[model samples]
Target: MAAADVIFLVISIIAVGAAALAVTRKNPIYSALFMMVTLLVVAAVFQMLSSPFLAVMQVLLYAGAIMVLFTFVIMLLSLRPEEMGETAPLPQRIFAAVVALGVFALLAFPAIEPGVPAAAASLAPPAAEAVRFPPAAGTGDGATVEFGATAYFGHTIFGRFVLPFELVSILVLAAVVAVMVLAKRDLSKRDVADDGSDRDPPPLSVSAAHAGSIASLATSTQPTSHGPGA
Candidate 1:
């Protein structure tokens, strides 16, 4: 095998291992760190594949930006160790492992075998050609439109799959709006009473209320001194 192939294999193994660790880690912060490692290794694999644009995007979007967001959200939530749920039962985990191994074996058999070419030829004609879009107006008739990485991505996303892409954006927007709505306090219900005469007090933090109660008790229990004549 070529040196490039060996490097790609190593990177792929590291990426897979990091992904598994990310999923299995008990701590959210550690999991996020592992996920960053996975993303970085995947970006390296993209570079090995001669896709510099994809590698840059993988690093910037996944490793840098998305991982930062994920870490921020995880820290903001402040989940306690006790709040984390228990792992799945051993039997259930074993069953899942078996299913995953079966799928991997099914996929690997065709990939590792030497009959892939024969299978591909049987599936489609060897002379089958790719569909190419027309060249730009300034370009000659015989010249085909040559698309770089960014241009090809833009064309695929905005040209043919524009509707789905737009719908995905709308879905993301809706999710954000929903989360904001859920996080907001329900002031409308608290502001009005049954007869619309009394308004409920805003909810106070437990520690603050406890401290206020303690202060009031201390003030009430204080002994008063009187003059001798009194």
Candidate 2:
């Protein structure tokens, strides 16, 4: 087998494994870390497919920025282990597994079928030998960059779609502000409840109740001696 093919398989395995670990982990921090690993592996796959711009964006947006946001939210929420709660029921988990398998089959079908690639060069091989689209723009030294090249995507995103790009940033900022508001409200409510403000106090334990009863009995008996008028 070719080295490129081996490397591709290794990266694919790492991505899948990390994604699985991320989903299965109980700790939010560990899950976030594993998810970052999966995202980085996906970026590596994009780079291997000759889309350096996409790889960089994946690393920057999903792995770096988004992960940081998620971590920040997790820390702010301060979700405890008890608050994490139990896993889904067995039947629900089974149903989810079935759905996941169906999605996997849909994704793997075209790749697994030999007729598609053999019939036409629909899917190109990876690395430098891969198919190239129309040339985008020429470099300073009279070198032409292809459509899948980084320069092409960068130029298109920054030049023509700058407004949409800035709009997305604004949207992300809005989301962050919304999360902070909700978290602060929730924390205030939690603090109020803990302070016993307008909430019923906890019931006394059996031993405490028994001790109070004994103390009351003793006081009633001793008070009889001092009640000479009665």
- Which one wins on lDDT? 2
lDDT of each: 0.62, 0.63
Local lDDT at 166 for model 1: 100
Looking at candidate 1, what is the lDDT of residue 210? 33
Q: Estimate each model's TM-score.
A: 0.59, 0.59
Report the poorest 10 consecutive residues by lDDT, candidate 2: 221-230
TM-score of 2: 0.59
Q: Which stretches of candidate 2 lie over 4 Å from their true place?
A: 114-142, 154-230
Model 1 lDDT tens row, 66-153:
6776665555445444344445578988998999899989888887888986787686422222135444356443243233355445
After aligning candidate 2 to the native by TM-score, how far in Å is the CA of 134 from where it should be? 11
Candidate 2 contains a number of clashing pairs equal to: 0
Look at candidate 1 and give me any clashing residue pairs: none
Clashes of each: 0, 0
Tens-place lDDT digits, model 2, residues 115-151: 8767656453333432243444454412445556666
